[model samples]
Target: MSEGDRDHSTGSGRLVTGAAWAALLLGLWLWGTEVTDVRHGLSVPATGDMAAVGRPAAAELPPAAAPLKDARPRRIDIPSLRVQAPVMPRGLDDRGGIDPPPYARSGVVGWYAAGARPGAAGAALFVGHVDTEDRPAVFHGLGAMRTGETVRVFRDDGTVAEFTVDDVQVVGRDRFDARQAYGVRQSGRAELRLITCGGTFDRASGTYTANVIVSAYLTGTGP
Candidate 1:
């Protein structure tokens, strides 16, 4: 195998550490900022500018909707990707990284229980696996989602928060910015972030080279 090819492996295993997501967890602690940066909205980086990777030139997104009361998420649906999955609360692991759903539950998505609740006035974070040992996972097609799409989060209060896709990025390991990636894009707006492993898998490192981040803002609501 060539130099880069040497990193190729035959099977997919539980690969979580070395992920750029750790930066997000660390950022939360060091920045002393709320999960959504209550003071202000975090802007996207200009240097790597991965925000519009899958956005269409003519996509016209809707304006942000009024923030809603806090409610725990029960499920998530991405109509475009045909992704409908359960949302389970997850906390940090011993290593301080997000302890996502177990590998066996790849179809389930994990929500940061301690952070902003979905439909609330903050950034609600959802994470899932891209793939497993022999099958594609819940977020396998996440990177293909484009701007102007929609993500629906069903809340325990019997309402659905409808979000409009505004940013989709494939942030590489070297350029991962926790604040920019996970921080709220607009103050007072209910935001959502769906994250998963992306880019080429490195067998040698047992991790992916990047993370696919899908950013959306609440634009409407439903019963």
Candidate 2:
């Protein structure tokens, strides 16, 4: 190739490369900042349709036996993963999904206050952030929880709701089944679900592509 021709080709290549980098950086900025709709993007849909009746029951049916007295959960300690974080009462966001703890308090977990309370005969929901912008958050290692592992929740009533991990499942955002992930599996059983974002991060959406749902049931109650 002639020297002039080679120089021209190299300059053109550099221009294309630089343009690609600029586009990539601009895309990330938009993805991260404009991802405000993620409140609804968490998982659960507007119908709250995690039910077999084609609509969510007002709530899960309580067990045949009376439910344990409601005790507000204060903290959750997952010893197997060494995850201990404060529990905060959280309600639905504008999108009708469980609002998460503030990103500034990423190390904490949010309890769905309107849902079943811990140790009660229904599903108690807890949600946390897996990571902050650059650091691991409260439920970062929750995927490591194994069957039969212990989860302890301390309450204000001086009793601890001890749960036995039943299973861990990761559901992709595209295929999230609210019934399987959040609905009560065994009628009347005191159940728990620890949820956090999982799967790959979508640069365009600025959200995780899946969710890690850890299911458990109350096996024993203690002080």
Candidate 3:
């Protein structure tokens, strides 16, 4: 999880093509339970050309609620994963890829402002650091989240949006499909994606071979 080489690492392969990430991940090896749909371990081959695993199609997912008023995500709480972090608005860099939360703010989660809000009528994006050169950060245990678990997001308007885990996938760059990771299957459905660096860390390249992506949809809400 080093990712110390550049701003965002990109390969000609399918991985860097999507807004999922551009090799912007940071960290070292982390040991614990991982959430998944296809495999058990988060480690992928050095080349990262493996097939991707993810949630089912939009038709298979439960429908979404009507879109909510635009409000920034202020906090995110996942009871099962024991993850609670402050949310920060993030925008894309010059390259059009979403900028990851700064390495210094390793404990914070970055919400893509250009994308859909947590309960809005589209795919909402959140990214965080997996780990740093020293130790684990906010999303270190991201892989441990299981299907049917709940992910709660508190917006600035004091409204809370709750989501249910539909799928958890770790996709290698070669097999990375931006459409699957960042696309909105249904135009009016509210979706959420939590992304961080995954797979085995390659010390030689200072980057992971794949990314751990969690997919969920709005299931409930509270004030």
Give the alpha carbon lDDT tens digit for every residue of 1-223 in model 3. 2343343533312122223466332210110112122232332211121233342223344455666777889999989769899999987665555677767677899987755678877778888877766667788777776667789999989999988877677777667765556656455667788888777765555657778888777878899
Residue ranges of candidate 2 with Cα displaced over 4 Å: 1-67
Sort by lDDT, top down from the best? 1, 3, 2
lDDT for model 2, on a 0 to 1 scale?
0.62
| TM-score of model 3 (CA atoms) | 0.73
Identify the leading candidate in terms of TM-score. Answer: 1
Best-fitting candidate, scored by lDDT: 1
**Local error of candidate 3 at residue 171 (angstroms):** 0.5
Among all windows of ten consecutive residues in candidate 3, which has the lowest summed lDDT?
Answer: 26-35
Residue pairs with colliding backbones in model 1 are: none
Point out the worst 10-residue segment of candidate 1 by lDDT: 40-49
**In candidate 1, residue 73 scores what lDDT?**
95
lDDT of 1 at 43: 25
TM-score of each: 0.82, 0.70, 0.73
lDDT of each: 0.74, 0.62, 0.66
> What is the lDDT for 122 in model 3?
70
* Comparison by TM-score, 1 against 3, better one: 1
Name the regions of candidate 1 deviating beyond 4 angstroms: 1-14, 17-21, 29-58
The residue-by-residue lDDT of candidate 2 on 62-137, one tens digit each, is 2222346788999999997788889999876543355677666778898878777888877788888776556777
